[model samples]
Target: MTILLWILIAVCFIASFVGLVYPIIPSAPLLIVGFLIYGFGFGFTELTISFWVIQSVFIILLFTLDYLVSSYTVDRRGGSRAAKIATTVGLIAGPFIIPGVGLLIFPFVFAILTEKIISKKTWNESMSIGIGTVLGILSSALLKGIAMLLMIVVFILYIV
Candidate 1:
């Protein structure tokens, strides 16, 4: 049972990272679930109050990063709400459709097309938005990846 719980917790942590690419997965919640499993299955004895507080802050940061980074990037490039929406859709669909590169390509293409067709932006502006979307995706992933690493570190420090 102990090993099984640990495996489940590890899966949650991994899935949380995977969620960075596939926005449909609830990344923060998965992390919380992993912690909860530790608390319940093994014991919460080592998980001090500070641990929870720090994790809570990281959770908030994760959520904020997810929303602010991508939106800000697109908006800075004069992208419309439609472009933002399409970028999200592309993020979710990209990996499955075209594998690794699709992650970047789909969002870029989607953002540009949405700007051109739905927002009636010029080709130049549309291209700018596409570039912004890709940049946003890359930066957001970098930040979130760091945060996730710190989160896991905190968990490890608390337990061992």
Candidate 2:
């Protein structure tokens, strides 16, 4: 029983990391679920109030990063609302289409097309916005990944 619980917890953590690349997955919730499993399995005596407070902060950060990072970068690059929407569509559809590289390529292509066609931007400007979209995605992923790692570490510290 103990081993099974450990495996379940590990799966949740692994799935949360996978969510970094596949934005469709709810990364923060999965981590929280993992912690809950630990609590339910072994009791929450070890998970103190400080642990919950810290985890809550990280959860908020994760949600903020998910909402703001990509759009913020696109907006900073002068991408229009259409471009931002297109970029989001590309990010969600990319992995399903190209398997691995689609995530980057689709967003770049979508943003550029939206800027050049819908926004009436010049070629160079469109490309710049495209680049910004990709950068934003990367930035969001990196920050979220770090935050999730910290969450896991905190969980371990509390439990161990």
Candidate 3:
């Protein structure tokens, strides 16, 4: 039973990493769920209070990075406030509205359109911001993936 539980935990960790690539999937919360499963399965003896607190902090940082990194990148690339806002809106709405591809594409499109129409930016400038938004999102996903790996390693250390 313990071995089976460990296998399940491994699956969850893999799924969380895949989620980082897919965008529509909720990777960070899934990682937290994985930790919770470990705690429950193993009677929580190894997952100390300090461990839980540290995991909680990582989870919070994971979610915040999704927003902060993208917005910061857009702003740094000369995106207007409206462009940033539109990118955020697209980030939230795209996955649900159009599914897999939308998650990757909508934010870029929205940022460009918002910059061009609302900010009166030329096409070249708007495109640059749009690219920045996409790059920022990708970078955040990469960082989150690394963090998830760290969390998994910590959990394994505690359990073993």
Candidate 4:
């Protein structure tokens, strides 16, 4: 591959690593981009279209599975539909107002508000659910990060 191609792959790799920590950045997809560079642009040419297709299906499955796993954890931990909606709003709004810390606080505020409204829970219970939801999301993200890191290692092993 050309220098430019390799440069682009390098950029994707770095971005994927950033995604590992940054909640907003999508790490797994970025890793997939790097894999695509190797598989489609060069390295896997002799491996056949069927090979690439099968590999692609596997990659997409990983992405979907990670998503489901995280959301499932949040839902299983008593996160209600309203709580989820509010948490999403908080997550989006938090960053604009508070930046780094907002990432943790937004979902918390949303969960509390949602719990208060729908569940008619006391302040203490609302707060508990809020904290629990935040913890769930954080844990899910951590697990997903681990999975993404493993995918990155695989890509590096195969491509590099």
Best by lDDT: 2
Residue-wise C-alpha lDDT for candidate 2, range 21-130, written one tens digit per residue:
88888899999999999999999999999999999999999989877998789989999999988988998999889876888999999999999998899999999999
Clashing residue pairs found in predicted model 1: none
* Superposition error at 21 for model 4 (Å): 5.3
Per-candidate Cα lDDT values, in order, are 0.92, 0.93, 0.83, 0.69
Candidate 3, pairs of clashing residues: none
Q: Residue 123's C-alpha lDDT in candidate 1?
A: 96
Q: Which residue pairs show collisions in model 2?
A: none
lDDT of 4 at 28: 64
lDDT of 3 by residue, 17-50 (tens): 8786566677877787788888888888999998
In candidate 1, what are the lDDT values of residues 1-22, reduced to their tens digit? 9999999999999999988777
- Candidate 2 has an lDDT of 0.93
Better of 1 and 4 by TM-score: 1
Better of 2 and 3 by lDDT: 2
Alpha-carbon error at 47 in model 3, in Å?
Answer: 0.3
Q: How many clashing residue pairs are found in candidate 2?
A: 0
